[model samples]
Target: MQFYLDGYRPGDPEYRPAAPGRDESSKGAAALPDEVDVLIVGTGPAGVVLAAQLAEFPGITTRVVERRGGPLEIGQADGVACRTVEMFNAFGLAEKLVREGYWVNEATFWGPDGTRNGSTAGITRTGRVQDVADGLSEYPHVIVNQARMQEYLLEKMRTSPSRLVPEYGVEATGVEVLDDGGDYPVKVTLQREGGDTAVVRAKYVVGCDGARSAVRKSLGIELRGDARNHAWGVMDVLAVTDFPDIRLKSVVQSPAGGNLLIIPREGGYLVRFYVDLGDLDPADRDARKRFTFDSIVAAAQKALHPYTLEVKSTAWWSVYEVGQRIADRFDDVLDAERGTRTPRVFIAGDACHTHSAKAGQGMNVSMQDGFNLGWKLAAVLEGRSPESLLDTYAEERRVIAQELIDFDLRFSTMMAAHPTDPAHPELGGVDPAEKQRMFTEAGRYTAGFATEYTPGLLTRSAEHQAVATGFPVGQRFYSAPVIRLADAKPLGLGHVAQADGRWRIYAFAGAGDPTSPDSGIAQLAAFLGESEDSPVRRFTPDGADLDAVFDVRAVLQQDHRELEVEALPAFLRPVKGPFGLKDYEKVFTPDLKGGRDIFDERGIDRERGAIVVVRPDQYVAAVLPLDAHAELADFFAAFMQPAAALV
Candidate 1:
C-alpha cells in the first residue's frame, strides 16, 4: 500500500483486490483481505476528509474506497458554499481555496425594484483581518469546484506516510457489517473495473455514499425523510446576467417565468431557475420526464435579463426534494432499548440526512456530517476514545439534521412565495429574514465549532460546575480562547488549533491586564469571531456561551456580560492573582477544569476541576477530571482505535 498511494495508477497485471474477498500485498506487508483499522467507503468531501484525518494516526491502517474514477481532478460547478472555509483551513487547504477562490464578502438581495432588503457579509474580512471562516473546519467557504478539492485531497493522501490509498472506483459495491450484540467486524464487497468481485474486511465500515446508499439499506436502517417527487434541473451555464441588478431584487419574476437565484460564481454567474418536472404533480408526471435542458433555459430566460443561456455542462447534478431528519431509533443501533449501544453500520453525510438545497445547506451540512463523525471514528481507530463514544454520532448529528430539516421547511415556504404586495400585483410576501437564516446558518452552522453535545455517554450525569464571580470562567461555548496576555494575541481556538497548540489549559493569573504586553492575550478581548457578530447571535450574560462558561466579565467588567447569577454563586468566577501573562501557571490555574473530563474525580476535584480530551480534529471528546481514567480506557476501548487493528 505504501507504493500504491504514491500516486500509483492502481491497476496492475497481478495485483487486483478490487473484488469481493480479495487481498493484495504491498510494501512487503501482508494482511487479511478485510484487516484494516478504519475502512472509508467513499471519496467525496466526507470520505476524503475522514481518510485524511485518520491518516494522521501512524498506528492506524487506513483505507479509502471511491466509486468514481479517483478524485475529480478538474474544476466544476455545484457543491460550493461560503460556509466550508473553516474546514478548509483545518485540513491545510485554506490558502489554495482563498487564493484561487472568490471572497464573497458582501452579497445583496434586491426586491423587484433594485431595493436591497437583505445583506450577507463577504466571507473575507480583508487583509490579515483574521479570515472570518478560518480555523472553523477542515475546509473553507470558497468556490473551488469538486475536482480542485478532490485533487488537493488526493495529493495529500498520496504524500501521507501512513497512506490511505484510494481504491476501487464505483466498480466496488456492497458492504456487509457482521455484529451480534458484540463487536462485529465489517466485510465489504467490491466489483473491480472488470466484473471481478473482491471482499475486504475491517473493524469499522463508514458509508459516505450519497442519499441513496446501498450500504445504509443493507443494514435495514431506514432513513426517515421526505423523498418528495420533485425534479429541479441545475444549470452550470456561462452567461453574464444583470446579477448586479439582483442586488435589489431577491426574487426576479417576469411574465415569462421566475428564476430563484442570481449567484455570481467563479467561472460566471449561476442563475438557479426551477423547472416543474411535474414530479410533484401526479397529473404532470409524464410531462415532467420529457423536461430537457432547453426547457430549463426557456424558464430561466423569462426571469433573467442581459443573458444568453449557454449550458456549460452540469456537475454532481441530481434531482430530489425535502427529506426528513429522523433515523430509525436507538433500537436500530442497539436493542429495543437505548441502553446497550449496538448500533452498527454507520452512515454519514447525505446518506444519513438528505434535504432540499432550498436552504443552501446541502454541501455545507453534508460536510458537517463528516466533521461530527470524523474524530470519534479516528479515536476508535487510535485506541484513545471509547466505543460508547460512537453513540454520540447519532445523538449529536441527529439533532443537526432535525434543525436542517426545519430550516429547509421554512426555506421551501419562502422559495414558493411571491412577494406579498398590496400596491402592485406581482409581489407577494416580503419576509426574507426567515429565508436568509438558511444562508447565514449555512455560513455559520459552526458545525465543528458548535460545542453543544446532547447527553450521551460523554455528558452522562454531568453536573454544572459552579464558578466564582472573579475567576476567568467560560460557560458552555463551542471554543474558548488561549489568550496570551503577554503580547495581547488572542489565539482562535477551534477544534483544530495551529502549531504551539497541543493542549492549552486556559487558567488565570488573576491580574487583569488593561493593556497586556503580550498581543496574544490582548487580542483575546477582541470580537469573538462568529459570523460577523450579527444581532441574530447576540450573546447576553444569560446566554450559554464562552462568556457564561468562563465568566470573563470581571476583566472587562462594564462591556463584558455574564449570566445573572440566580444567587451570585461564588464558584463560577475567575481566581484572582497577579496573573503573569508570561508564565502558564501564573495565568492558568492547573486545578481549573475544562468542564467536561474523561476521568476527573467528581468530589476530590472541585466543580471546576476537569480535563478536556481533544481529538486531533480539536473537538472535546471525553471531558472528565482526575480519577475517571478507567472509564477513559473503556471509552477508548469501545470508541477509540483498535489496538490489534492498527498497523
Candidate 2:
C-alpha cells in the first residue's frame, strides 16, 4: 500500500497538505480536463458562486475561466441586502462577511440646502432604513467590496470536495452548440495568456462575463433598453469631515453642488460617494476626463458646502453611466434538432442584466442569478431532472431581470433628479415623504426578498393562499424558529433549508398517536417507508442515496417528550450520516412551553397540517394537505424519471 501528500512524489515518506491556492501547475499540477459537466466563463462573483454551488454535487465537475489574472481590487458595488445575507448564512458564509463588513441599519437624509460654506448644521434627520428588510430575515444588510466577496467565494470553492480551480489569464473566445447529441453539447475555444488556443467540451456553458459578454453576443441575444443618459462619479475615500451623516448610509442633496449618495464601508473611516455628474454629451471627451478622482472629491466637498471635507486617501473610484438593459433570453440552444431544445448555453449576472449599482444590487443579484442556475444544471446533469428543467432558468430569471430593470429605471431617475433640475420633471418638485417612499419602495425590490417565481413544476399548488399564514407558493420559504424534538435545539426553518442541491419535504404531522390509521404522520410514514416502489423510491435515480435526493423532515405538533426515535415512523426517525453518525435534527416541533410557535408563523394548521415541498434552491415548490402523497409523486414525475424505469 502507498500513501502520499498532494504535492509529494512517490518516494517521499512524509506527507504534507498542499499550500492553499498555490499554482500547483507550476509544481507538477495536472492540466485542465478535456471535458467537464459545466464550463463557466468569467471568474466574477456570479461565476465563482456558481462553481461553488456545483461543487456541492459529487458528480458534477466545473471548469471556470477568467480573462483577468485574478480577482478585482475595487469598484464600488458593495451592498449585500438582508435577503442576500440570509442566503450566505444558509451556506455558512455569513459570519465571514459580518466580520469583514459593516452593517447599515439606518439612513440619514440632508436636504433643503443644509450645507453653508463647507460644513453642515447639525444632522437634520435620520430614517430607519433597515425596516425595509425587517420581518424578512434576522440578518441585516452588509457592506463589503466586490473583490473581497469574490475572494471568499473562491476560497470556498478551493476547499470544496470538488477542489475546482478557476483558470486565470484564459479567455473564452467562442462557443458553439453541437448537434451530435452526445453528453457534452457545448464546445468552447479558450485562448491562453501565451496566445495559444485550446478547445474543450462541456455539458453546459454559463457566461458570467459582464456587460460585454462574448458568449451572449455569440448567441445573438439582443439586450433591450434605452440609455438613461445619466452618468455618476463614484469614489471611496478615508477622510476627515464635519458632515454628520458621513458615517451613515445617506442621500445628501446639496443646494448648489449636486445630489450625492453616501455609503459607509466596513472599516469605520472608509466611505463611498456616488456623485451625479450632470448630463454630459456622449461625444464630450473633455467632460469625461473631468470625471476623475480629484474632480469627484472636489464635487463631494462642494455638495456638502459647509461640511469640512478632506480626502486622506482613496481606495478606489470610477464613473459609470446609468442604463437599464436585459438580454432577451438567459438560456438558449444554437441549433434546433428533433423538436427538442438543447439549452446547452446559458448566461447569468451582468451578462443578463445591468443597472445602476447605487442600490447595492449588482453583485447580490448577479450571484443569485448564478445560484438559481447552478442547482438546476446540476440536477439535470445528474439525471435527477429532465432537460426541460433548464427552461425555467430563462423563464424565472428573465422576469427578475425585467423587474430589476423597471425598478432601477424608476429609482435611478429619482436619485439623479435634484428638486431644481428641470431635466427630470417627475422628481423636480417631489417632497421629502415622496422621496422617502420612493427609496423604501425600491428598497423592497432591491432587498431581493420580493423575488417570486410563477407557479410551475415543483411549485404546482395554489393551496398556499388558502392557508392561515400568507406564505405564498413559488417564493422562497421564510424562516421561523422551531425546536428539534430529539435534542430540543432551537433552529430557524430557513437556516435548515440550506442551498445544497436536494428537495426538502417538510411534513407537518399534527399531533396524534404513533400508530393511528388516520394520522397524517402515520400515513406518511407508511407510504414513504415501503421498500418496493415507494413514493420516494419513484422520485430518485436507481440505487441513489435517498437522503441526498430528498431531505425529509417532520414538523410534529405533538409534545417532544412523547415522541422518541424508536417510537416514530421509520421514515421520520434520525437518519444515519456517512460516518454512521445520527442526525436527530430532521424532526422538529414548536416549543409551546418555550413560547415559540412556528406552525402559527408559517400558517400551518396544527389540526390538519400541510406538506411543504422546497426545491434545491430553497424556493417553496408545493404546499398541500399532508395526505396528498400522490400529488407529491406527480410533482417529482414532472421532472424526474422513476427508479423502476431507471433499472
Candidate 3:
C-alpha cells in the first residue's frame, strides 16, 4: 500500500492516472487497436487475470476479447483456493473477497447408518475434517460466484495505469503465426457481433477460452484423455433442508441412492449441490437432455435419506459428464524436435486442461495459469527479459495441469463409487474413512501450495536449500509475519510483493550487527549497490528507481526499536519518486509480540544468513549464501537483458 511516491496531490492515491489516450469517456466505444503487444481470447478467470496483471505494465499494449455481449453474470465456476486468495492479495482484492465470500472451515462426511431400524437407511455423520490443513495458508478456501470474481479483476484493470477494458461482442475466428520475424508475428481474425470482421496483429496471443477454445483449435492441438461415463448434475439453489450439516461443506453417499456434494454458497441462503446422475449409456447421444432441474433436486433429496430438501429457487443448474482431458501441448511449438523454436501463441485455463468440478480446482488452477504466464509475457514485451523466457510457460504449466487431472480422476472415482455394496462385491466400494483421509491428504495440492516447478531457466538448483529450508526453490515463497522497521507495523513479508512485475531479493542479516560493515547484509548491500556487474546495476535502466527492476529488502535479527534506520545500507533505503523521498519500508524484523520468529520458522541460518530470490509471481527462484554474488548475477543474466542493450 505504498503511495504518494509521485508527490501525490489529493484524491484517491490508488486511482491510477489514465494512460495518454485512454479516458473514462472512451471506455467501451473505443475501436479495437489494429496492433497490440499481447492479445488475449475469452474473459474467463484465466483471461481476466492475465489482463489484470498486464494492465500494471502500461508500456505494453494488451487487449482482451470475449464472445459474450457483456460481463458474466452467473453460472460457471466457484471455489477460490487458498493460493488464489494469496494472489488476489497482490492485486489488493483479497480482503474484499474474503468479506464477501463464504469461508469453508470444515468438511463433514455422511454415510448410510446400518444401525438404523427404518425401512429406508439413514445417513449418519461419519467424519469431519478441516477444509485446509493447519498453517497451509493464511487465507481460507472461499466459495463465491465466478462472475463476482471476474468483476473484481475487471475493476482492477479499469483502475490500472493501462486502463484496460475488454471488448465484448467480439470473437476470435482465426489465428496464424507468420514465418517472417517481424514485431507482430501473430495475426488474429476477429468477428464482431454483426457480419463485420477485422484483423489484428500481436506479438503474443494467449487462449483462455474454455474447453472448446478456437485458439487451441487454430493451433491444431487435440485434447487427449478418457471420459468416464459418470454423469453429475450441479446446481446452485436456495433451499431449506432438515440436514444437520446443511451449512457446512458435506459429502453424502448412499448405497442405493446417488451421492451428493453440498457446498454452501456466499449469501448463506444459497448452496451448491453436485448430484450424481448415475452412469450414462455409451449409446445415448444426449444424456444431459434427459435430466432436468427437478430430477437433479429429487436425486439430492434421495441422497440425503431421512433429511428433506425443499428448493425454493434454482439459481443455476447444469448436467455434465465426468471427463478429464488435457491438450497434447500448451504452446504453438508443433515440432519440438526442431531445436530453439520460440513459442508465439499459448493456451491456458480450460483450454489446456479440464476436469470434474467436484474437486474445486478448475477455476483455481486456471487463474494460476494466467498468473504464471502474465509476468513472463510482460518481461519479454518490455525488453527486460529475452524471448526465450516464454518457452517455460508451457513446460511448467502443462505438468501442473496433468497433475490436477490425475488427482481429479482419483477423487471423482471415489465420489462416484458405492460404499461397500455387498451384492456387487466385484466393484470395490469406497470407505467413508478412506474418503476422508484422501481429502485430508490432498489439502496441500487443492489449496494450491504443492506446485513445484522443475529446474529450468527460471528455477535454480537447490544447492543452498539448507540455508532456508522452508522457502523451497521452485515453489511459492511461504509468507511469514514480520514487523516493519520504520513504522513498527506488523505484516506478512509476502504482502509487500505486488503484481508490478519486479523481482524480490530478501537479504537476511547474519549473526553480526547489520549496521557493521563486516556483516553479510552490509557487504551484500554494498556489492549490489556499487558493483558494476551486479544484477541491480546491469538490468535496471538509467535514471529509474533503483528498486524498479529488483526490490531489495533486508530482515534483521534485532527488534525494530533497537535498530536505527539511518544506519542501514544505501540499498536497503534507496531514495525514489519525483520528490526523491527516502523509502523506509524495505527493512523488517521478526514480530516478537506475535511470537513469529521467521528465522526459526523458516530455518534460516542466523550465523551465515542467506539470500532468497523470488520471481515476480512470488515463486522462490533461488536460495544462496549471502556472498554468492556471482551465482546471483549469472541467474538473472540467463533471462534478463542488460539495460544498455535495450537502449
Per-model TM values vs. the true structure: 0.64, 0.90, 0.98
> What would the per-residue lDDT of candidate 2 be over residues 13-98, giving only the tens digit for each residue?
52223345433333222145788788899978789778879856645667788988877777557988877777677566887888
Instruction: lDDT winner between 1 and 3, please give it.
Output: 3
lDDT of 1 by residue, 1-647 (tens): 11232133656522323222222222212122457766777777677766666655545666776667656654433334544555555666666777876444443432333332223211111111122254343334444566676666665555454544677454337766565412336677877666767787776777777667666766667777654555555554455443444222133333223435443445444433443232466466554456667766666654443334555655333333434555553113644545465444577777777666544566666666676666666555444445666777777777767777766666555555543444574555543443344434544442323334554554432432322221111212234343322233343334234211122223211223323433222333232223233111232222222221122221121111221222121222222323311122112111112332111212213333333343333334444432343443344333333232211
lDDT of 3 by residue, 1-647 (tens): 98878865788777768777665653752257888889999999999999999988877888899999999999578898999999999999999999999999999998878777557677899999889989888899999889999999999998887888899998999999998838999999999999699999999999998999999999999999988988999999999889999899998887548899999999889999999999988788687688998899999988888888899998899999999999999999976442467899999999989899988999989999999999999888877888888888988999999999999999899888778755576778888888888888888988888789889999999999998998999999989999999999999999999988899999887798889888899999989999987999989988788898999989899988899999988778898977889999999999988998999889998888999999999899999988888999999999998653322
Identify the runs in model 2 with alpha carbons over 4 angstroms from their true place. Answer: 1-30, 114-123, 126-133, 283-289, 334-339, 420-427, 468-470, 514-517, 531-535, 574-582, 643-647
Candidate with the greatest TM-score versus the true structure: 3
The models' CA-based lDDT, in order, is 0.46, 0.75, 0.90
Clashes of 3: 0
lDDT for 95 (candidate 2): 79
Clashing pairs in 2: 117-305, 118-305, 118-306, 118-307, 119-306, 119-307
User: Local error of candidate 3 at 399, Å?
Assistant: 0.8
